[model samples]
Target: MADATPYEDSTTPSPTVLSQDITLNWKTKATVRLYRPAVIPPKKKLPLIIYLHGGDFVLYSASTVIYHNFCNDIAAAFPAIVISVEYRLAPENRLPAAYFDGLNAVLWAQNQSLGIGGQDPWLEYADFTKTYLLGSSAGANIAYHVALQLLDYDLRPVKIKGLLMNQAFFGGLTRTQSEKNLIEDAYVPLYVNDVLWSLALPTYMNRDHEYCNPISGGSYMGRVKGLPKVYIKGDYGDPLVDRSILLAQYLQSCKVPVYYRFNQGGYHGIELQNTSAAQQLYNDMTWFVNDVYQNLNSQDLSHHHASY
Candidate 1:
């Protein structure tokens, strides 16, 4: 995974961070930070953004080196409540475990109103009509899979708005340009892709199955047709970049409304590098969020749900 963003010269304000804590399994406790402007929020409730950090689904968490910082920056930049899930790692908890945790986290946030504090009205509070699911790398894969599950369960939250995938993970049967050309790229090589699937497949029980390859999964594709608008971001240099592009193509082919942006420079997850590229991507994300949230008011969402 191309987890680091290239360094660039720019002057941007630092992020203001707050805390969100949750205990899922009895032995595992996780804490994620919420970032926002120091100024008092204009509304009691704002849009919610739940993020799943990517470390090839094995190496990282909310406590990892970059996860906390990324969450803080996103919250500070966007006028939204951001919840980062610190899921269990693979080779230990394995595939379905992470997906299960992510799904529960979303449901929990929808009901909890206030995050960990339960008293800090601004922390976990959100307008259900504008909740978003976002993640990078393997986290992106989880986001897509979990969204499919949400659709199947008829548990689509009234407030759930859309999905944002930064350098998403989606592998098709055919080869993509990034996969063909960047087989040995430093960040994400073809071999790494195979390894991730190996780790994630145990959860699905079939590496080639729909739960693993959502595009081919009949149930997932059916759910995708009913999903909210999607936004995907990627770069040309990264191996999985083409995967994101192809997924966008598939979604568009299926007539799903999708917002796609392909950056020119940098490799995978460059937007998380804490650089100018990262800031630009952040701005784009917030703009997309504001636009979608503003338009996805209760009535609009209700209509969509009715159609579903």
Candidate 2:
């Protein structure tokens, strides 16, 4: 998979877009690619978006050309600072490895926001207080796990206001109607999904594991209650659509604020392949981010008044 190069660097140079790669942890070989708008006034801070690229947990990295292009485009479109995390993959690093790396990346971002970590020009304008965790496919799964981990600790000035899962990769022991119907697709086939789960999940664990299937219950049910507002997108033709639906229902059951969008006649990862679809998804995401920002401001104001 590493030898397979999907596309040449087709990223159009934009005066408004600027990006750089930074190492998060040397020992774990975890890295992050930071993207932000080039123009910013003095003391201006932008919402920080920590992006996890999708590759079924075993395929791609932040350096992948396609993902790099996606991150660059979104950074410019949203006009926010995007930190695309390069977590350790599976079959070599396995389950929990990527999750740990993701958490570490968030912590590293926190340190940067607090001015304790090594300097980076982009992070200087990052508003960690209004952070968002976003991912697609397996990356979205990683983002979910990382958010759960974050709940265990108190992170001041680095609040995770929302989570955006674009066609999130999730499965279970039982087959859904979409999965049975859409055996083969352009992005990810049924067999490929099965293989990815095998490679990513622990040896003893099956598809029912909480890592692969959050609704399988165990720890996830308890953790789901405190999760931030979640926005989930699903493709009609994708096999994983049911998984997203189930997740939305589960979140709603837990009384967590959840927003979901399902696209018609779309396959898994269609946004990455279709320009129009990608643009629409980006627009939706921007709206979600704006809504979250307004809520954050209101919450802060309420807290301030209560403190007084």
Candidate 3:
């Protein structure tokens, strides 16, 4: 059975933002909740952020309380169009299942951009040229893979500016220092992570499966050469911090422009723990999105929005 979005009321506009749900696939219940700033700046097409929520790929929905609040905050703060994807979870639907749903969500956005599907008014303000995939933990993993999935697609009018990952939950067969040190972690125990892997990964695969550990660098790793500029962020207290470090190292070696912000201390998903951290994250995200226009892209964002 597919999990339903548990949020009872999403239509009412908050002071900062407004949100509503869209059912992308009726059968599988694949859905996306679209969020936009309440008072959209007229005549200004904002950047598009296709967000995947974090729950070890086995828990949470796009409408889950924490993820919803996170999206609302960022949509208002970054003042961008934030589309949160709700895909089926695992122990029932595993690995590639969530990944494919991520791709589908992106395709839906593509259709909206090309005006091929039923269009929504908020999406009309999306500056596809300034698009981004933003996710945290397991969602970050999905964002990275989905970005790879779109590599072959022609990106003339809609280019993904960059990826924004926060404490990506990557794993490996051999333990890193942080993983070993944090095995007895209070917030995220290693035992719990193992259980999640068992549920989310394919029956035949283990922790080292490419989906869990991209650091192994196989065919999928080679494809990452075409990845957009990346913004990877993590805190020192998380066990997976080492894997985040390893991923940043590998991408840098591949000559992909990788921006990293590793703070001194934070548990798994610190942003969810309090306001200060989330604000700092929003701070980093706004800077990154702005930097994408100022540095990674050739045309000025205002000019791009006007001309396109």
Best by lDDT: 3
lDDT, residue 72, model 1:
68
Q: Backbone clashes in each candidate structure, one number apiece?
A: 5, 0, 0
TM-score of 3: 0.90
**Which order, best to worst by lDDT?**
3, 2, 1
TM-score versus the correct structure, for each prediction: 0.81, 0.89, 0.90
Model 2 spans > 4 angstroms off: 1-14, 292-308
Inter-residue clash pairs, candidate 2: none
**How does each model score on lDDT?**
0.68, 0.81, 0.82
lDDT of 3: 0.82
Tens-place lDDT digits, model 2, residues 132-235? 99999999999999999999977877999999999899888888878877778666788888998999998989998999889887776787899999888887
CA deviation > 4 Å runs, candidate 1: 1-15, 24-37, 114-120, 153-158, 172-174, 203-207, 292-308
Ranked by TM-score, top first: 3, 2, 1
Error of 2 at 61 (Å): 0.7
User: Across residues 117-213, which tens digit of lDDT does each residue of candidate 3 receive?
Assistant: 5677778899989999998999999999899989978755778989988999888888888888889998779999888999999898988889998
